[model samples]
Target chain A: MARWLLISVIYIELIIVSLGTSSVAQGGQELDWAALDWKALDWEALDGWELEGEAFAQARYFPDNPLYIGQHSQNQSLALELSAYRKFSDSFSLEFIPFYRHDFQDDERSHLDIRKAYALWASPTLEIGAGINKVFWGVTEAVHLVDIINQTDAIEAPDQEEKLGQAMVSLSLPLPSGLFDLYLMPNFRERNFPGEDGRLRGALVVDTNNPLYEHKDKDHHIDWAARLKQSLKDGELALSYFEGTARDPNLIMPLGTPSPVLLPYYSQIKQLGLEGQYIKDEWLWKLEAIYRKGQPNLQFEVEDYYAMTGGFEYNIYSIFESSQDLGIILEGIYDQRRDNALTFNEEDIVLGTRWSLNNMHSTEVLGLWIQDADSSAHNFVLELSTEIGNSIAVTVEALIFSEQQRNSDSGRFTADSIGHQMRQDDYLQIEIGYFF
Target chain B: MRNNLSNPPFHFLASILLMIPLLVQAETAEQKGRAIFEEIDRRDLNFGDFSSDQEMILRNKSGQESRRIMENTVLEGGNKDINDGDKTLIIFREPKRIRGTALITHAHQQRDDDQWLYLPALGRVKRISGASKAGSFVGSEFSYEDLAPQEVDDYTYEYIGDEIFAEQDCFKVKRVPVDKDSGYTQQFVWVDKSEYRIQKVEFYDRKATLIKILTITSYQQYLDQYWRPGYLSMINQQDGKSTDMIATNYVFRQGLTEADFSENSLRRAR
Candidate 1:
């Protein structure tokens, strides 16, 4: 297993080196050089502190969701985060962030993760960085299935199963027609158990501001990304890739087992996304689509998978003089799995409304119906969020889930068929935050 | 009884004569208050050649005094286009900290006005948009719009009533916002009994909330004809910030021009 993992790690590194060198040769741009104007870094341009940070306490209670492992299981979780950033100069600054999350049920564990801790050197045409960072790639509202090429979460989950952190160097260049960003990261495992291997990662992301109509001045944008694991936006797009292996591919296997250990597989994921939004007076409409392939971690089996997702959202405000806004969302996903078995498909419909009582207070109600290969569920959520003062905010959420189907082990029903009968679950969450 | 019925016209004339004194007294007070209010308006319109010294105390939402400062400046004209070929400048001299910083704003009667802010740190001037006038200025209790020259034609005013303010008789006038986008819905002003100068003005937001209060104190006669408020303070009810404008020097000169209001000229202003 160790040999297999080592081989996989080496292969990934070779691929990354070859791709990065070729792109660099073709583009003729140095990855480590920083070309930023220092005069742009005047602190006075920011004026009034421009310093903001927030801390919050949140609790979630989930009851009887079809995706749970057992007949019924409930979990409670708590999380806290703090962040601070100050501009030393207009083009350079230092930022620090510390975060912690603890789960009370089941595993009963806690983890502290640094979401962002770095110094940034930025100019109108370039940006350079060092430390923990996040990259944004897609423009979808509900679920950005195509944004998988980057190292950030496109889904709703606040925690990432893969703790991906690396010593990274990035560069941003503004082209005459578009923006190009690239990144190069070296892998150093802080906690890799035996039989697990780790390697370097790199990525590139490109965004083009293009307009579909001649009369409109570029309301639409397109993003393309390719990476070894995932890279954030504003890095490099052409000369970037990821080269890393799973930490523990053979968790419980003996040291010298004859059984072939899961080979560390080197994979390259690529993504393409497009988005357009139009706003006329009080009416807003948006449409987005994304496509992703070669997601190794997303594979349920030994083979890789690909997914394509698209969604649309519309908002109409003050339709009846009640200061009310109506929003509707629709999303669809197609997932191609390995082994030519158990393909995943998802479709969702969401309807929501927001009522503005004043500038400082608002209430929202949302109804969502999600259908997947194994189950279908309906969720109704209501949220009331208000700013009590300049630095204090409170939000309360009530959610009720209705599972329409249950999975059975009789082999008489397929996973897709069982998903049709999944029934409902319920949950509640509340959060209060303060900023200074 | 028969003789009284025949002389009914004479009896009615006597009754009319008796009511004249009461009517005269009511009319006189109204006339006095209106004159004072109009004089205050005129002085504010032609506000030039006046200066004073003042101190401002700012409190936060937690009822803590966050800052205190003393300032002095000279006022030119209250017209929005005072710098437009008029060459009027309001120069600050005291408060060692903010000394030499000038706020140069050009007002236009019908269109949006332009403002130039000169900061000591940058040693350069920045042009600010007129759109921001709707909000509070530098966290002060008064909006930037309130600090600018207000055209009397922008609002239709009504003489509501007479009352006593700060131990002095005054006239209460009501003014409504005629601009559709004004953040304020209405304003109530009180004029002093003797000087025809505004003593207080209360501003209400669109939601009918009392958002700001302006009080004028310490009056002085300029050019022996124009009465000017030596000190003026505005308190923001929501944020608890206050701004006091004190005049320290007064000079009357006809040496300004409209050519000075151009954007290019503002960048080159000394």
Candidate 2:
């Protein structure tokens, strides 16, 4: 009941903030672009286009045996990303970025994406942009609930940190109170799942060839979003709303299908999110909460729910009088949907620590432990990375899974929980990259 | 005797005679140090705003060297009524991997600064704790505390005897940071007498051991008033590592407003 009240208060605040008049349009001396003199602006003196790129190779080794046939114990992949940027004038610029990856096994794992391709027109008071872009929005170290702008590129990694490019037309207004942004998306992108031969997948693979959607327009449905973000002297806050196709798909098996394959079903959803953070000396407090409607439950019935993740990070600078900084992080997660929720973090605790060596090599280490509140299920992840020379960097990561609900027969494993589904997929990965 | 002491002329004369030594002592080393620093601060008071291109070359003990290039913009802020401090934006341009990365800082006079870092790869702007200001900046010998705008109240000063440095007569001043979080226990600063320009600085660690020495050179006057350094060299005396920072292409009074230094602009700092 208190959660409902808190959401209600936030809704009221959102209404008030949105209703406030925009100061950008209030200026009477707006320039008429059509009447502006173009010849007076020199075109020959502008700087030429610049290019940057990164190429990397990665290997993952699963300690536990594969749960299904065709799944390999070892996986290797290579990826490349290139970005081209150009500035036509002081207020106008263009950027294009393309990425490609190839996997030695699992053909579906190899993919290509246009991370960013956009033209931006910016001024002191306003900004307008349109193209394929990526927008990240959240303030949590664990699960990111408020970040809904892009589809998750799940095939790239299980950490959910990789995102697909989004096609959008955006407008930004910087006012005295805060920065307001509006986004219009005319198309939808589906989340790619791991292939049948992938290691970190459930017993039954998702039939990506055929998918279902609640909206009649399918991938052509129009979506919209808006956000109001402000940075205070010692804190920051953001209020956001998105109405579109849900990023996460619900898997269901139809009765009449010839094969018993799980088909992904995308449903429409409306999400209201709030993010805030405050810094007090060496401690940083963060919170991300959302109230989502029209999401499917386990029984395929649409339901409304609220979820939140709050955390704090305390920093110890120059530990032992050395050039190292250690940050202790603790966070709590709560979701009203409980068992029916798709994510495993319904009620969990996240504890993590980050250490930065602050040396010439820029070495860093991160360790995270997530525990299930009601059961003996947990996940541990550790990562260490450092730079070599001026252009090369290497990273090593390990993911460990522990669960008591693992069935003896992996094939007959039910859709009980994500932690139980992939209990045998613990793996260690290493990556090396060259940037130019 | 009491009557004589109470007499107006006698009392005034006695007080004047007694005040001679006290008056001479009034110009103590501490006050003189503060006055000299105040003069130094007053001379470079207002440039409004400036933007500059910088190159930092890092050299290790093995004599290996690496370079990083960046652009910086600083908005002068000392408005007590508005409670505003100096705002700075630094955007990295070189070392291809970290290109487009930016950092925005809001410095405060009496409290910890507020800092935000923008990672272009993730399209994320993260607020980092300012408690780590004592740490090295981007693996350079310069600490964050050294880059931050130095406010007069941030340190207590004591003027030492004059000395000659770099072929110039300089006043040596010992300054201890008022903030306990400072990496250095104390620092000795040398300022030339002619323009009150910083000539050299020696940093002493917590154990009163000299750790680093910085030298500023290539002074160029802008707007016929402000003296800006064209080059800075900081050497870690104990570690045998050093960093050379060369700043050029300074453009002052660019008419930059507070909006340019907003968090929203960090992603678009290029």
Candidate 3:
């Protein structure tokens, strides 16, 4: 079975390469280099220290939200992450990161997580690592269609930026045409969601513990993922394949007490992804596409489909006579399932802008709007962040959901879907983070 | 390593004689400015490649300050048909949250420079769009347009006469930005005639009003060829804010290739 998986991975990679060859025409300027986002912590207070890494603790709060509260709820959380590594030998070492969380709103949302615990042996041209880690792959900003390695931690944030750790044995080797990465993921992890009384909770309660997998091995299934990334003269191209259980679960309405419970069905899948982007002066064009041979939707039929997203970002510097920049981004998302697509972004448009103040405080703002083409459904998000003193930073975020398809004939088709189900989840979030 | 343009006419009697036509005939003020700018640009272009450590210290009106440390690597790009500009990569090392973040700049002599930002936390590379050149360089007083390799063609120069400033004979040159989208309308530069080094610069706003001033305090010669400044302070004339930069640890010719500045190698830049 491993041999078969490897063979099919190679075959699919070849097809993707062939299809991408014609489109890989040229390259452009690689500016956006040296760009600084002050939102990232700067340890100036501990400057000139010989340490090779950094650590930070942050706290988050929700000033306003339309949700029922539980006893002792404070609608706040304190989280911290420390990323430090030690080299025992010259070329071998260990990396461990322990993250802590405490949520005043929900106890289930607070827990200690081992984000990365790995031992690595690296050389000039080859590298090998084993343990739990997170891998990210995708190009576009608004949505990530090709990043499928880690399961989403929904309770952490709705932006899908939080990922659960995955255990794996990974290897990277230099190929003649590009760099190749091979992975043997030994454990399957299900996505996490907020509890009933927690903020950002879904309409139906999610049963994360009793996930039903297509394979009887359940979490013991040995999954596989491979990627070939080539750096072109003007741009970059990557082709990847993953044969594993799906990270996203299909919701099943199991008959219980009829309080609307969601049973997660984890299906086995074979996925192929292609991503490419070019950097031009004052503009960047990006594209991502994925084909999957498994059930990604609520229904278990057809067993095959594809989804794609493409967009470009243009910049306008020194706006309104200030030495700041405003970057405009636009992307169109499409899925083969079209209107029936489970993903809320299918047949939708993403319009966003990024503002950089270029001050010492690294003041920045990002605004995004996701609009459904078939209906008047839309999701809007805004994030504004700045630094306070040397070690502390503040960020404010607001989310709005307007589901025109709610409770009507047009809303019935969108009922229980991502956008409609999230109609009342709009919230205002404020976070003040301190770094050490 | 000085280019021919940097060699003043006073160095040779024959070259001074060649310039007699300009003084005696139709020598526009702009021509004189171009001549002086060419000399400054030539003296500035030395060394093949180098790396250094940089600190940006920002202070508000209240005198409270914040600092950032980064490793900067630069590769000269004139000989390979890329014109006489250079490529620069800056990696933030001190910031705990932004550790391993890298930014690349591909500067050109004729067109607008390009920029790419790599966020290590997200493991992603993104291109910065819009008039990026006019944007600030990481919240510092120095704008991206100010840090670019000031190629001769990117500006129109004029000789503003010579005077003794900073106790040295200096040529005051007025440079008008050729790029239409430049944040600065014009800049007044004072270069020491003997060393061809820029001593002070005054920036005019987009409306051609004086806005900021940059002063270079000290310089150190590396590889016995490149003259790099050790301290620079930029003051905003309108606001009370300022930024001071301390550049240190200059290592030249550690064998950096053009490939070293590419996005592929940027992941491990630190």
DockQ winner between candidates 1 and 2:
2
lDDT of 1 by residue, B132-214 (tens): 44544333354557766555655657677878999889888877766654667888889866777779999887778887799
> Which residue pairs show backbone clashes in model 2?
none
Give the share of true interchain contacts found in each model.
0.00, 0.55, 0.58
Evaluate chain B of model 1: give its TM-score.
0.67
Candidate 3 deviant stretches above 4 angstroms? A1-74, A86-94, A118-131, A169-182, A228-237, A255-260, A278-280, A404-416, B1-46, B61-64, B79-85, B93-97, B110-112
Model 3: per-residue Cα lDDT over B75-194, one tens digit each:
887866345468899888644446578988878666556666887656566655424677777777888777666778888888899988789899999998888778788999988887
Query: What local lDDT score does residue B108 receive in model 2, on the 0 to 100 scale?
Result: 83
lDDT against the true structure, per candidate, is: 0.45, 0.84, 0.73
For model 1, the local distance difference test gives 0.45
lDDT of 3 at B71: 88
